[model samples]
Target chain A: MSHRSFVWLCLLPLAAVTVAFFLLPMARLVVTGAEGPQGLAGYLAILTEPRYRATLLNTVLLATATTIVTLIVATVAGMFLQRHRFPGRAILIAMLTFPLAFPGVVVGFMIILLAGRQGLIGDFSNRVLGEKLVFAYSIYGLFLGYLYFSIPRVILTIMAAVQKLDTGLEEAARSLGASPWAVQRDVVLPALAPAFVASGAIAFATAMGAFGTAFTLATNIDVLPMLIYTEFTLAANFSVSAALSVGLGIITWLILALARSFSGSAVAAAG
Target chain B: MSAQAGHGASVRIEACGKTFADGTRALEPATLEIARGETLVLLGPSGCGKTTMLRIIAGLELPDAGGRVLFDGKDMTAVPIERRNVGMVFQSYALFPNMSVSDNIGYGLKIRGVPEKERAARVAELVALTNISGLENRRIDQLSGGQRQRVALARAVAIRPGILLLDEPLTALDAALRDRLRGELNRLLRALGITTIYVTHDQSEAMELGDRVVVMQKGKIAQIGTPREIYFTPNSRFVAEFIGAANIVEAAIENGHLVLPGGRQPIDGDANISAAVAMIRPETIRVLAAESAPLSGVIDSVSFIGDRQRLVVSGVSNRSLTVDAPNTVRAKSGERIGLSISPDAVRLLPPER
Candidate 1:
């Protein structure tokens, strides 16, 4: 075979996979979104319909909060974890990253086990206050579940970034009359910005599309994934479910794109 | 050497030693005093504790207990680097890659709560002083190696530090750039006059930039003196071999002359010691035709370097002797050449350990 044709032939598997699993499903979903009783306006129900609109807003806010909180907690923990050494450091890092190996259903189960009616915190609060303080099966419970999985993803990225940081920059800042806080603000944080954007986007996208956790402990909360699940399974509304699925994917992808461009300046400056 | 262009703080470090957590001793208990507006260089090979000493002075690494650092007679050892008000430049330059050139230089001022307008003025002044003008808005990666070095210096000096600590600041540049920047850095350091402490392994850098050089070895201070003293009157065999090229000739002093294998070269020693280890600089020996001179050796090899030619002469000592002759002098390999020397040029040194 000629070299040019050989190179083109090498790409055939990737092209076939993309068309079979991605493009075909995506095109069918977009067409199904408009083939409903409401016609093309079915896509607008995600925005104009109060229940669908509330679920979208709820999911967006939860994902954004999860991303912000994950970045803050993981950055501090990751920096400390990467910089210090003591007994049990290896085990501690392993424990922190253990969530990455857990499925979403497992994380949701862990949250329920910690805060459910018979859980340790509820049992302790019942003894102390004469009333059980259970919050499982609620939005708070889902938030906790999302945090458990998101923290590990962001922490690993931040830890790697912190490990690769040029320590000379901190020394230079200190030698130039920067206080510890000033050094973190001027040198450390800016150096870690790209990692924050990259990993936070991943965490945000994951939270937006996470389904198993919502399925496990979701009764009182209204979210995009739970709504789409009910619409497809119980109500047998394939068109609306497909439309919501597209909305979810498009919204998550758009937010990630926005974050990427926001962080592009940081990467350029660091270059 | 004491031009005193800017405010120069007198620094004294006493009994400073560093023992890491892993039980490795980086520096032995050492004491040093740097004068106001003077540039003192710590000269040694890698792992010789010169950088450890500089860090102790800069407050990057604290000295062990009982060690004290004083600035102008006041103890400042407890103060951290930020509050100690010292400026430092590193081999990596360490300029902030996330900020513009002006912002990197002005960061210290901004941290101190200096007004933005005044911060800008100080940054501008330093930019002009370090000769990195018109590059304020440029990103760090956009800069060449030399420009990065200039920005590092400018950033360090923008705070108007009491002392400037530089650790191999020019070691990262190319040879030609290092040579050119050495002259520029020397001029800039002298102009700032901020009691600078420079650490480097290059002997030429030590000789050129240092008003007084501290020669260190294996975690201990070997010798501390003017560059001329260290060269012309090295107290130990290590210093003699470490700094510049030297032909160490071990021979006995008989009747106020050094008796050698080649011939009896002249000596100006008291002859108290029967055997002596001596250092003779290459440029001190003059070469001529073997028939007219007192001592002679065959030229082993001749390397024609610009401005001078270096000749390796055999059969003069146990090892081949390196002799640098003028470029104008005519010499060839395998030729027997007469050697001329003045007795005063020979420096007697302590025996090696």
Candidate 2:
């Protein structure tokens, strides 16, 4: 037939999949969110209710903190790894990115093995400081788990950006009387700003929606994903949990949209 | 502008050489001096130690132990590039993508703590000097290749450095643009009169811009002289062939004449040597009537270049000889032609390696 018709026919499968799996489910979630006893006000309860509001705030704060700390640690480590060559460098890089292969539950398990009661850190502190230090079940444990889950992706992105950097730019800066610190401040950091925004957005969204890590750590963590699970399965409060699901998805998507716009301007400025 | 001129310092590099960490010898130890307000060019093919020498002078690479670099008699071997007061134009131009054209030009001044008003005035002066006038606020990627080159030059010169090091600055542009910029850069360097060291493989650039050219080969300096001296009185076959197109003839000498397959050509050198190598430039060979000249050859091919036609004539020496005749001459392949040469034009070179 015609070329336009042929192209549309090729796209028919993708359209069918999107309607059946994505748009229909999203529409159902929105409708089911308003079907509770509180009616449409059940959606508002995610904010008006004191318990849901605290959980939402805790999740946002934890994700924000995780994103910031991951970007900092990844940028420094990636720059060092990209610039230097030594024995076992390839193995070291593989080991650094090994966490990407682990699921969230495994990350939570690893954090407990390092910082939980009867863990290595608790044992060391008990012997040295005369007090058993344990924090694996608190928000701090979840934060550590999220860091372990997010750092690998951010580090890979920052490393790729560092590799694309031109050595001549640094040399030119130094030739123009810029000190080492000044070169980094003016040239290197500005060139890598877009990478920071791009990878930081992924880390933030991942931390916001992560559930298994919180489940493995504790039941009282109060993160949005864990709260949604409790409301859906334990309390049998399906409408509130659906509303919270829609809220979490919208907030994550909104933050990512904001980050993409910021990165767009950053790329233009860098250019 | 004249007040800013003549601020160049004479540079002396004593036995400077570089051996990279991986044991690759990038440059052999060699000593050279550049006078104040003079432009010296290091001309060679790629991997010939030209860039390594320029880096040693720019403080980007350190020479091996026992080698020293001095600026106006002060030892500067320990000084870092940031404090060396040198301006460099890299092959990539290396303009800051995040900064405006004016900001790139004023970056060095800003680093030196120059006041905002003073930096702006200096930047504006450089903008006009480099003919990039109305592009002050434009970003680097917004400009064309030629504009980026101009901005790079202005940025390097805005600091009024004591020395300027350019490493193949115009090598990245198209041929037509490179020719135009080469002339402009020549004029700019003359006006500024800074002690400048340029590194390039383009001979025409070295001839037009350099006060003296250092021809390098295989991590060693092959020759160093004025462009005319290097062109006319090259000491080796490599220098002669590298500087321009030359016909190197290996022939036996008898009674001060070079024995050739086509004919015997007279030379000014001693006749005692059994065999010698001689160099003849293409343009120096004059085409003449086959019956009138002592040397003759049959034309193998003729290429009609705009100003001159190059004729590849076989049966002349051991190999075919290239002759650049005026474009007006009518010659074709398989035609018999005579070649005339002055005895003084034939340069006797040392035997090939």
Candidate 3:
């Protein structure tokens, strides 16, 4: 066979898998989205329907908030962990990253054990404030669960970045009369900008598309993933659910791209 | 230009010693004085404690207990580097990559809360002074190596520090660029007249740039003197070998003459010493016609080095003696040549510590 034909032969299996599993399914989903009563306007129904619009806004806001908070907390923790050496420091870092191995359902379950009705927080608050404080079925519970898993992913990237920082740069800044705060603000933070963008994008996109935690605590939460699940599985609204899935993926990807352009290398991190 | 930058401060380091946490000695107890506007260089091989001493003076590292650093009659040992007002240029340049060249140069001034217009004027002045006038708006990553070096120097001087500490500033460049920068740095230092402490392993750099050189070995100072004094009248064997190429011959001294295996060499030293070590710089030894001098040897090798020809002559001493003959001399390997060295040019040194 010719070289070009041989190369094509090598790519045949990969092309078959992509076409069968990915391209065909994606095309079917797109077509199914337009097959609703509103026709192609089913895509526009995502923006016009008040209930669906609210769920989309809620999901976006939660993801953005989680990303911003994750970056702040992780940057501080990562800097401290990378710069200092002490007994049990390695063990502490291992414990912080232990959540990386957890599924979102487990994270939500753990949050329930901490703050659910008839749980530890409810019992403690009942005694202290004479009330059973429960938030396990609310959006706040889902927020807490997202933060739990997002921290480990963001912290590792920030720590790796902090480890590669040049100590000479800090010393040079100090010799030029920069105080410690000034050194951190002007020198160290600017150098870590790329890491922040990359990790923050991952945290944001994960929060936007996450469904397991939302499903576990979906009693009161109206996040887009939970709304899509109800429409498809409970209400049997396949076309609307398909349209919503496409909308969720596009919005998450668009935000990630915007972030990447802003920070140049701010990109989505792996799971 | 130096008046605009500010006056240099007199610095004194008293009995400074450094011991790391692992109990290894990085620098031994030493005392030194640096006058205002004087350039002092610490020259030695790697791990010679030269950088440690510079760090102590710069307040980057504290000395052992009871040691103190003073500036202009004031004890400044307790001050930190940020408050000491010392300018430092590292071997890595360490320019801020996130900022433009002008921003990097103006950073210290901005930290001091200098007004925007005044800061720009000062940065402009430094850019011109360092010959990087057109690169102000460029990013640090976009700059060439030479340009980065100039930017580092300009940034360090922008703050008008009382003393300047440079750690192997040109050691990162190629040999040709290093030599060129050596002359340029000397002229710049002379023009600035700052109390500058320069650390380098290259002896030629020390000779060209320093008003005085401190020769160090291990964790202690071997000798401290002017470049000429250190080169010509080294107090110890280490100083003599570290400064320049010298043929060290071990011999017994009798009546101010060193008795070698193949020749009796006249030296300027005590006449009563039973045994001694003497140093003869290669350039000081003259290769002569075989009949003119008593000391004779067969040239093992002749290397033409453009400006001078170096001949390794055996049998003149127990070890081979190196002679730097002028390039014009027609000499080849395996030829017999007489070697002549003046008594004044031969320096007797104390045996190794």
Candidate 4:
């Protein structure tokens, strides 16, 4: 066989695996959600019912809140990691990105140990303030849990971006009568805007679609992911669960679309 | 754009030096001056601290000790770069890619709070001055190298700064573009008469662009003089060797006459020193046929350049010398030849340290 033909043959299995495992499943899910039983009515019901509607709204709100907080923390950490030379900086960076290697269940359990009612901060709060602090069982708890995974992704992405940025722009701005704040505002921030948008979109999508962490921490709260799980496994309502899955898929797709648009424009502007 | 406005901004450096935090002495204590409206080129090899001196003058770097920078008789040692009222063009041009040509040119004026209409008018004037009036609305990426260089020049001069600093501005261009822009640069700079400090390592560039040249060595000034003075009469052995291809022959002064090896004749210069190196330029060496020769040598090799041929001659003492002859002067390998140099063209430098 020719070299080019051999290369094409080598890629056939990987391409077939991707189509079978990913695209085919998604295509089947979409078809099932649209054609099964009550069909579009079932999807509409999930959007209109207050219980499910609140789940959607809460997902968006929590995701946005998580994105903002994660962005701030990650941006600061990323810039510090990129610029400053301090002791143990490599260790710090490793620790920041270490969460990505762990399963979501493990991260959720770690958060529980740190902030659950019987956990470290929860026990301290209860004994010190004479109240049981539900830090691991509330919506805020879910956010904190998702943060373990989201913040790291944001930091790694933004740090790579910051490292690759042309440092001359900042020097040029400073030489042109700009104070530190002015330089950050006029030069540094504008240069980092595209990376910020891209990482924020990823963080939002990850937080919204989080299932394992949400399921592990769903004690006093019922998030969209937990509700979808309960409809699938506990209530035995395949139609409702599929509809919820489709809804979550659409939200994630929207976020991915926004990310693509932002990244595209960023490249255009840089060019 | 009047020439009178750029005068009277003389810069004086007193014992300026820079030692980086890592203990590398980037620049040594050096004193110099740039008279009003004078174009000074800091010429040196890489890592010789010429760029460091330019940065110090631009206020981007602070000398470690024993230095004071004065502008127009005012001590500006503590002044920051932005407040120094000096303009700079970087080696990479550093034009804001996101900005149009007009906006890039108007940046400094805008930062200085020039009125909007005035900024516009001044940018228009500079665009025309740079011969880039039609490219005002183009982004930096859309412009060619020569065009970007013009934009960078226009941007540096838009504020009517008292001093202008250029860091290897033409090093990025091709030979043809560099030559063309250098001529234009000379005319424009002379017309504006800005107190300009151009930094470059290219000897030809320094000779062409500078009214005076400051040749620097490792963290110190080797010599400072006009192009003619530097080329024709270098102050030190390093200057002579660096500025051009020079034939340095070690000679001794015995009884008020120079003596060289291989039965070569003495060249006339000050005979004060007991021993020194005679610096002779390549063009000053004349080649003669062996029969009518004063000092005979074998032609080791010949290289035919476009206008002239370069011949490598080895004497009986194995002393090799390079001589430039007209392209019409042809010689075969291992052929006997005679080399002679004019006495007036020889300059003596102190023995190598």
Task: Note each model's CA RMSD in angstroms.
Answer: 2.6, 3.3, 2.1, 3.8
The deviation in Å at residue B5 for candidate 1 is 6.9
TM-score ranking of the models: 1, 3, 2, 4
Q: Per-residue lDDT of B5-52 in model 4, one digit per residue for the tens? A: 456389999999999988999998999999888899999999999999
DockQ of each: 0.84, 0.80, 0.84, 0.37
Off by over 4 Å in 2: A1-6, A265-271, B1-6, B269-272, B328-335
By lDDT, the best candidate is 2
Give each candidate's interface RMSD in Å.
0.7, 0.4, 0.6, 1.9
lDDT of every predicted structure (CA atoms): 0.90, 0.93, 0.90, 0.83
Against the true structure, what is each candidate's TM-score? 0.97, 0.94, 0.97, 0.89
Error of 3 at B255 (Å): 1.8
Task: List the lowest-lDDT window of 10 residues for candidate 1 chain B.
Answer: B1-10
> B189, model 3: CA deviation in Å?
0.8
Residue B306 of model 1, lDDT score: 97
The true-structure Cα RMSD of candidate 1 reads 2.6
lDDT of model 3 at position A120: 94
lDDT of 3 at A41: 99
Docking class for candidate 2: medium
